[model samples]
Target: MTTITTRTVEYPADGLTMIGHLALPAGVDRRPAVLLGPEGMGLSDVERRRADALAELGYIALAFDLHGGRYLGDPEEMLARCLPLLADPDRMRGIGHAALDVLRTEPRTDPDRIAAVGYGTGGAVGLELGRGGVSLRAIGTVNATTTGRPGEAAHIRCPVWAGVGSEDPIMPPEQRNAFTAEMQAAGVDWRLTVYGGALHAFHHPPVGHPVVPGVGYHPRHAQRAWRDVVDLLAECLPVTEDLGA
Candidate 1:
């Protein structure tokens, strides 16, 4: 296994101090980068570990925070915070751009070759970043098929790949159709995958306590979705031999 280094970084966004985890692969002066976002519950070990895994693949990965450095275990609290934020595209862009700035400033990052990937709320933010005209090689989201404001998707210049559980009530059929329509109308390159027999947050592992109704983890689909995400990154942001031996 290749050695990787990671650290916690603090920055300001949305009237709070945002904490982000940055990971870098060993022996790489510069590499393609990815901005990782977490679910509405906020950044946890899951996202941090994902950043580390991306680093091992020779990409500079930075998992940015939501809700400061805190994780909301309460579903109501998570919604209360995420709903309004999601409603405001500018606010979502603020959070995303803040993280992007940190990632771009990292010495190991190849600023011109970067992508955004997120889950749930984080995924929404990644979409917002693309919609807001950020130059990204690609965008990938899991369990977040939320549609952006009218006509904003035309600003997205890269391909978008999204995956969601077919039974995810939060992102129902109508919502999925609307998202696809928006992407199509904008002439954006996009793909959507619906994993059958899965619920919301299928990518997550089993939590110690019960979660909201219609939210549970499906281990098999989870692994498949991850492979799909990695494939997207490989296609859009290929790692060269100089970065990965």
Candidate 2:
């Protein structure tokens, strides 16, 4: 198994002191990087482990925070904080850019070879970064069905891949259609995958805390979703040139 190092990172964004997790692969060689985002429930050990996993794969990874330094276990509280954040493009962009900056500052990160991979509300932020003209190599998201403003997607300079549960009421067929329509209209390279018999947040693992209505986990689909995202990254930003994936 490959060895990696991890640390806590403190940065300011959206008028708050944001603390994120930074993970780096062994050695000092610069490598392709990922801007990882947490779910709407905010940053937790789940995201930290994800960052460490990415590091073990030889990519400099930063799992950015959402609710400053806190994780919201209460579904209601999570919704209260995320609902407004997800609805505001500028705010989302601000957070994404701040996190990107932090990732770029890492000595082992190849700034020009970076992708944004996120889940749920974090996924929405990744999309917003694309829409806001961030120079990302690619974007991969799960359970995010955000439709950007007209013509904004033209600014996206890379391929995008998204996944959602087919039965997700929060991101039903109509919402998916609208999101795909926007992508097509802007000529952005994009694809969507719908996992049948799954519900909202199906890509997420089981949580000890209460979850929102319509949110559930499917172990099979979750593993598949992770592979899909990894494949997208491999195709768009191959980090194996430095270390194994």
lDDT of each: 0.94, 0.92
Best by lDDT: 1
What TM-score against the true fold does each predicted structure earn? 0.98, 0.97
Residue lDDT tens for model 2, 38-152: 8999988888888898888778999999988988999889989999998899999999999999999988889899999999999999999999999999999989979887899
Local error of candidate 2 at residue 73 (angstroms)? 1.3
Lowest lDDT 10-residue stretch of candidate 1: 236-245
Compared with the true structure, what per-residue lDDT tens digits does model 1 show for residues 1-245? 88999999999999999999999999747899999999999999999999999999889999999999998888888889999998999999999999999999998788999999999999999999999999999999998998998999999999999999999998989999999999999999999999998999999997775467889899999999999999999999999755445
Native-referenced Cα lDDT, model 1: 0.94
Which segments of candidate 2 are over 4 A away from where they belong? Answer: none
